[model samples]
Target: MRQKMLLAFAAGAMLASCGESENAEGPEVADLLFSGGTVYTVDGDATVAEAIAVRGDKILYVGSAEGAKAYVGPNTLTEDISGKIVFPGFTDSHAHLPDGGDTILGLGLGGLTSAEQIVHAVKAYADAHPELPAIMGSGWELNLFPDANPNKALLDEIVPDRPVMLVAADGHNGWVNTRALDLAGVTSETADPVNGRIERDAEGNPTGTLRESAQGLVSHIFPKPAVEDVVRNLEAGLAYQAGNGITATIDAAIMHDHNEAAYLEVSSRQDLPQRVRLSLLAAEEMVTSMVTPDNVEAVVEKLVERRAQFRAQAKDRLDADAVKIFVDGVPENHTAAMLEPYVNAPLGPDHRGEINLSEEALNAYAIALENAGFQIHIHAIGDRAVRVSLNALEGAIETNGERPRRHHLSHLEIVQPEDIQRFAPLGVTANLQALWHFNDAYISELTEPFLQEKLHRWIYPAKSFVNAGARVVWGSDWPVSTSDPFDSMEVAVLRKNPDDANDQSWIPEERLSVDDMIKALTINGAYLMGQEDIRGSLEVGKQADFILVDADPYKVLPEDISDIRVLRTYIGGRQVFSAAE
Candidate 1:
């Protein structure tokens, strides 16, 4: 009887410490408490907890169910999860939300395998909306066309009278009908730009296919969407991100010339659901014009004033981290600058892979930007362009040393192992899109013949970089790819085309664990943007940004990882997404 009394006294003391009262009247109090679920907190130690507590946009406690219950107050909202899984809200390091929104708003031809199907979809959309002036569409694959490349003649055959401009899946090219060409004033005499190709036939006639810079010819003439339409599209994009449990996204390339004002206008309102980071780009000539020798001090003062005003509103959301410079186009259309001649089709005696900037000019630009303390994200695809970019980066580091600010390599599709090492030392973050591994079969076909075993190892080389001590971050390259972090994570972990059965995944050894992958999508990205203390993972006193899934990725088979559904997304203690009404 004495031993039993002692045990009862200890138990009572424990209950008291947990703040439990046997005679309590109301429902268990907690600002937000969830139990009967697995919480995979991607903390530094990767600890697992049974429950979490939130209070006014911050996580107050994360421990046992009993511990979380202690924070319950009179008006607490308690949720019994009954064995679900939760994780930190996903963050997309790179995206094009507005562009993705625009594409989703327009005709979606992503899955169509043939021209006939595209025609049917286009005709159906036109019939449904008779008031549309021109039927514009995007996401057509070059392989789907008869010539292995698209042409306006085919679109002309489908809808001869109506003008159409359909962008290729890669976004590096487009196909416009005769009417669109006529409207854009693109005639037989129009010459291709220095870095872009205007596809031509044996007779030297325009073939309606615009490659690289030439696509601008038709794009400049396309009608702009109304403000209302823009708002709808932006909302659609945010909804898509929220639905996928993404809390933040970085717009990889922001064409401020066309849409910065609209972004400011839309963002001024309260409709933005996801946090946005926009990278600004200015033409080389325009950048030079801003810093002329005659009025350098005045220009610097003006830029500082403008930056201050932008900072006052943005605080952390908007950043002018870098000025984008296009060194060369993609390797798909034979425009990317390469060290060696392509095996399939060698260039003539005078021809080489297209180099947009001469070495002298590029070096000068790099020095100037480095001196001005601007991080540069150069578009490099071919080996030669990559070399040029590396040289420029080396110049920057030699002049300004390395710092926390990360220089980016956009579409770094073909990095040599040595170049990755160079990046680590220079503090250049490898902002890679793993989904590109599943897509871009055309690239595989071209690279396989020459690169052999090295063909598909470039996209998201997680294991290699981690071993090398490089800070690698995951990005969706949205609009170019889906913004869904789950989908992106699935692709990274599995390294296979979820849709293709016959296609093989490259370098199975390159796969990373779920924990590492989540860190890349969360903490690493947060650290890159310098928001580690405020966002990233769930911890006491941190912002309450998290997502609850129907299943636990840690316990599930890797193949089923992609299918795990998102039940709800919470940001700042508010329910941003919930399955239940």
Candidate 2:
């Protein structure tokens, strides 16, 4: 038949490419050979191959099964991956791996939809671990509660004796019981810190809700997790990522001083399964103090020193070449800086949120870091914040000359039309959380009212950026959102809540194609992390990082993408995870 003839020709081509003798070979040679599957190369041509061969940690050949057989020696480990789909291992462009791990191990509040569920879960956890000195947890959404603000009295009703503090889903707010507030000495007179707020009642009493930088007040009182605990949580997180098909991730914000050491220790012991890029926290103090002209030089010098120290102690598995900066807070808290006035400001109609760092200061800081050979990753959640971040990066590029390093702006929740075009020309990466572009309770209840008319116009302009020739990358911002790439991809393409598929798609015009979403999760993420040449695609000579899926994402309905589970995961020619095993 014609099919048989085509197969034979493809096999012949593979044999020719491998340069192996079919008749004289005692035994072929390769560390591993995977055959009989649809291999998505994700290369320039997006070629689909029938088989692939790996030698040690590198891919030796990618073609037909006949070609791969040439490299199959006596020691080869072969896998017959029939009726499956293979893709380049996913990379979460931005995530809080350690925090996610900690949350999983501690009080997990990931998917609860109501206060009753959260309270019941917390109470159960507290009862199970009565030996603990204090209780700490996160993953509570503001929109889940009435008025988008959680009350401390609810937490007090459960753990009236032991102190309890739970962080908001966004990681920008915190809720604590009365005992926790007392433990932190947070009285009504405890003035709010710069760039942070302590939400209070009408009577001027502390409401037990802390926003932005103010969470540090109570956090400082909580006992730090032991080093072993930290490592254990990190490993748990890495394993979770691998199970979900992630081979690489960037720890977006390294806030604690000991986190760097923990990462280095893990990398040295070869326990880290995924490639990790760390962006150290440089925004908290710098944003508050760097506004003064005299303070800019000192702040930049300090950042440069931190970079040098990290690089000197860097390991091969972990990279520390970027710094994370927060431009403003989230819109739910009314802290995200906006160019125009908020629709109904509590203080006044003219109030338009707050900007942590001025435009000039951000520009200077970016320029200094860019000149010192470092990439900048900024969190700009509002329209004005996004514009200011773009302007700062532009100023840096103009002043320091365009370098190979590509700067990133994350959480593009609201980007102006004019700013959408700036990304391509300035070579800026739109690091977006695709899972957020949907009709979720957070969007419909908490965020939409504030934006008023601008709500539809400014929410996640992903397609616009891609059309403008800008490289768009995807991230989960885990511990803040779901880290599953499938979940994110589904939202990106469908523009609807994956949990409630029947819900109407929000801003469906901005939806992306499956192909574009795949690129954002794989190649684009790799490029953002500066690992494009070595990984990202399933090409020969690249690191063998890939995963086997239960179904083909391209062939299935877009809504079913998130339902397709990862059957197996491989890195450096070694099997790292398997559903069966």
Candidate 3:
């Protein structure tokens, strides 16, 4: 009797009467109904409905709560969502998120912002677990050290006897101690790999820091965790994403074959709740040791096999059909390939940093990958890096002609005006990392000075890309930075630090509209992974993937958008994450 009264009251708040005059047989009953809430249906018209109805895994009706009542028969489950806000579930287009779960299981270094804090935390973790022979942890911020570089002495002071490996929050660089280096036998005589760096001092001795592929040398030595341990971390990470209102992810890196086992193990248990599109990475060794005109056939064959293997064995929504290319490194380390030299050129006057592969080689590789049916996802930061990656995609198109592939480029940090227009014509999606658009400590301290005023103004041109008719999308790059979609949407709309929430924007003209951000966070991202036809929006026939937040983003101030909390997340009309629980 109480439930009936509540439902009747909620039905009063329903939208304008749609099919209110039901006939003799009555209206079709829906299995589930959500009413008395603001539903931001990110559809073609951007409809704001008072109720949404679902039957099984697909959306049945999205109209007035009064209309919804006709579908709410005795067997229908009803939710009176008064004062709540609903939106399509967010898709983190590009992220490395296994760390989200791994951090919870063992030693985590997320919030430590100081070097002293990090070293002591490593020492404390080492002390607490003396049985471990090596210590490994991530989430070290770049602003904590000079030029995002760290050496061994501080860590050596703490645990000189044990092997210590601390990875930067961005996952591009690594810090190690003397013990680990000695174990790897990386002396001054050890030459840097083709696409990596082993930071050294004036005397050419290893400074205990590794960048790019160089970290792989020592990281391969760490003992592998048990299969069950990996499955637990994978589950925890996926749930963490769901808790943040994310229903899908384009996992930006898959370094080895073993990485597949844990994800497969979890999927076999029917525990996989989110859509994952893994981007298989090509290491420096593979390009140098295996790729050539004569051996390219075998290289292409291996790539195809791996992509097919992941797609074929799926108990749940798990897939891998994309390839990842690190065209250059980040500017903080002076490894990003730029058209002009960085201010005061750290390496040399004419130096513009590293380019992992020659343009010729990249063109060949791109053509092969595309011909073999793999979408390419390139990491290009500097202006020159962006140009070269674009050139490679252009070559792929000319060689293989056009099919249906959503090839994309991530981290367009310093795109030139000419290249900005090239993205749409060449058919590449500008996968914007919107969270980094602001003038934070990292940008204020190192980035501004490094790029200077000239090139710095061109940073994260969100509106410009959209104006150029390029399909733009946003990503969290989690484990590198914050993964909250609200935090990211806030930054994209304000072009200022969400935490600061100040009036002084980074580059005001680049600020996106609220509608622009919602589209990027939803449909645009789904299109990038080829799932737009099924999900990405709330409509009559689409999958029931959406979230209920604490407040309506449209009603809140731009600065307060980050304060919106995810109350409940639903995928396939089934509850996956609930904050109240």
TM accuracy, model 3: 0.93
What value of lDDT does candidate 1 attain over all alpha carbons? 0.67
| lDDT of predicted model 2 | 0.80
Q: How well does candidate 2 score on lDDT at residue 571?
A: 80
> Which sections of candidate 1 miss by over 4 Å?
1-30, 146-148, 269-271, 284-309, 315-322, 346-352, 359-375, 446-460, 501-503
Query: Which residue pairs collide, candidate 1?
Result: 29-72, 30-72
lDDT of 3 at 207: 89
State every prediction's TM-score relative to the real structure. 0.86, 0.93, 0.93
Model 2 residue pairs with clashes: 28-72, 28-73, 29-71, 29-72, 29-73
Off by over 4 Å in 3: 1-26, 269-271, 284-295, 501-503
Model 3 agreement with the true structure over 431-462: per-residue lDDT tens digits: 98888888887777767687757887898789
lDDT of 1 by residue, 1-581 (tens): 00110101111111111122223564334478887687766666666677888877777777678667667777888888989987887778777676678788888777787878887887787778778778787777766664446677767776677678887766677788898888888877888765576777777667888877677778767687766776677778777887888887776665534455556555554335676766554432211112233443443344344344445565344555555666776666666676656555434534446667776566666666666656666677776777788887888678766554667776676666777677777777767677765544665554444332443466335567667777777777667667766666666766677665454656677766666677887787777676788778777778888888887665566556667788898877777787762
**lDDT leaderboard ranking:** 2, 3, 1
Superposed Cα RMSD, model 2 = 5.0
lDDT of 2 by residue, 135-155 (tens): 999999898876667889998
